[model samples]
Target: MSERHPRILVIAEAAHPEWVSVPLVGWSLAQALRDVADVHLVTQIRNRDAILRAGLVEGRDFTAIDSEALARPMWKLAETLRMGQGKGWTIVQAVSALSYPYFERLVWQRFGPEIARGDYDIVHRITPLSPTAASFLAGKCARAGVPFVLGPLNGGVPWPQGFDDIRRAEREYLAPLRAAYKLLPGRGATLHNAAAILAGSRHTGSELPASARHKVFWLPENGIDPARFNRVAAPGDGPLRACFVGRLVPYKGPDMLLEAAAPLLRDGRMVLDIVGDGPMMPGLRAQADGPGSGVTFHGWQPHEAVQDILSRAHLFAFPSIREFGGGAVLEAMALGVVPLIVDYAGPGELVDDSVGIKVPLGTREAITTRFAAELARLAKDPGALAPMAQAARDRVTQHYHWTRKAEKIARVYDWVLKGRPEPKPDL
Candidate 1:
């Protein structure tokens, strides 16, 4: 291992920036770690061209392992079952669970010899962020004497009890069945051998075996890229511009935000910019009608455009019911747009009192009423916005930037390899 920095072999089976959101984290984290660590990313062959386009040289910065022979069959099955994206993302993950072992097996087969020969200082599994995807290579790393780090793994966020209707609409029938994953093969070994396990949310951490909780670190999976989110909101003199950026889906709760904001929007007291498209778009548009609905649907804008909208808006409103990672919330915070999020899963972990407003989970009507009241309070008190916005931006800058998260990873590496003590618990 080089004395300059720990040589990290980052394995991400699903890293592709061109795809939807989750993979972006993989790309961002792997790249950011290069800022402080000698990082060599290893991902599936599917991500090769995109990785190459991102200017990462082959063999130098990363190694693309092709496991398509095994993965494609599982992928086809998931697709055949009409479960691919949006409401179907969970089913895709279910299929991924079946195929991930093969991906890791290939990685272990390729890198096992080097790892055994002490070629790297750290072995980090940065993706399959789902905590249920137990690492097949953990035992190999343990036997080889190189420390392994799993996570920031998230998932296992239960359906909020009162939202039975929304859960049905989102087709989250398997959510209740998620507990069965804890009984999957290798989970015990994966937990026992890891030097550190970073849980992305309290829900995920609680799912860890009680004996392994000591190894758990509360590190949220979502983080902002400062360069992309450098714009500060300029909330103008007219209507209080509030924006919601995410798929227009049931779980994302865009409709809940709209229902809550309806009164404020009707009076022209607030305007909303909904920057995404999904199955919920048609229904959401129907709800956006009256004179001052003030809702502008910029259907599925590019990443740059979403940032532009966030830059001009005053507040970011998102009320996802079971969010595993609220990366969008951090993006808003990074842009100095105060976030108004549901106080439940991932967003609950990322936002604190000083940075953002949290609406306690409740029945649909109760949550909508509470959410609207918060909006009305913020609207009535314009002076409160700047401080909250500043704090939100400051929070992300200090704790939720990809580079900042990478630096934290470096600290975890130091503790694992240099015999330093674990950082204090987040509670």
Candidate 2:
């Protein structure tokens, strides 16, 4: 291990500065790492313009691999298979499994010599965060004696029980076939050869084979860029101001959130701000339209508007049942708004009693009841939420900020370079 900063080749095929979801995550992480390591980012050609706009010299700071010949066609196929946009995410990933190899193959073709000669201390693949997306670089780097790090790999959270109707509505037809990813080519070799694996969630961490468990470390893939989400909610003298920001789809439980908060909205005990749009908009709008139902629908606001609404909010009432990363929850928490999320999957894992609230997972009716009860209780005593909101903000600053995540990843780089030390980083 070098005493100087580790030279890392960060591979994030989906990274893009202007996008959200996986692309933003990959872009944020890759940029953050530059402060701690000698990072050379390699990404797909589609992100080249965005990367250039962000001020990086092409072929010097990064290299854009043109894999569109295969990626474009495969992406079109995935779009068709998904049935509709933003639906059938599982189907998209399942189809992408076939085309991702081409990107890595081109990456190796260009960088193999430098990697083989030990020019880079480590090769870290940060995107295609799906645990199912096997890496060709893992075995290649392993054979070259250069340590390779995989993930904050997330996804593969099974649809929880009692959500079959919503699952079908969301067009997640391929979810039952998700386990077949383990049988994909290079899946075994990628896991077996990686020097360290960063599992983004506990569910994802548990999915790795027993042999790979020893090298795995828990690190949530979602992170907050403090500058983007720095607003702190100032609870004024009024009803509890709550907001729900996500697609108005069955799985996100927007309808359930509306049902739960309906009483409060009608009684003037709470004000609800719904900050997104989806297929269920017309139905949800109708559901909220009665006397004194203080529900405001700011349909599909930009990130800035979302943050504006969240900053003035006291509670973030997001009842998403099967969220994998829960990035919106983090965004809300970053704004010092206490989140009330279901006690399952990503939200359950990100929050605890000190920072936010979590209601037990159950059927749609049961969850709605629980959420309603919690919202009523909170509305009755809004002053008690202040402490939790501050704690949530502090938690994000310490752990969930992109800078902090980069620092933690730097520690990971050190650990892997130090020959697999005992007591892995408990980040």
The number of the candidate with the highest lDDT is 2
Q: Model 2, residue 233: what's the lDDT?
A: 84
Worst 10 residues of 1 by lDDT: 80-89
What is the lDDT for 271 in model 2? 94
Q: Rate the local accuracy (lDDT) of all candidates.
A: 0.85, 0.91
lDDT of candidate 2 over 1-427, digit per residue (tens): 7468899999999999888999999999999999899999999999999999999999899999999999999999999888798999998988788899999999999999999999999999999999989899999999999999999899999998989988898899889888988898889999999998999999999889999988898899999998788788886879999999998888888889989988888889999888999999999988988545798888988777789888888999999999889999999989899999999999999999999999999988899999999999999988789999999999999999999889888888878888534436465
TM-score result, candidate 1: 0.96
Top of the candidates by TM-score? 2
TM-score for all models, in order of appearance: 0.96, 0.98
Model 2 steric clash pairs:
none
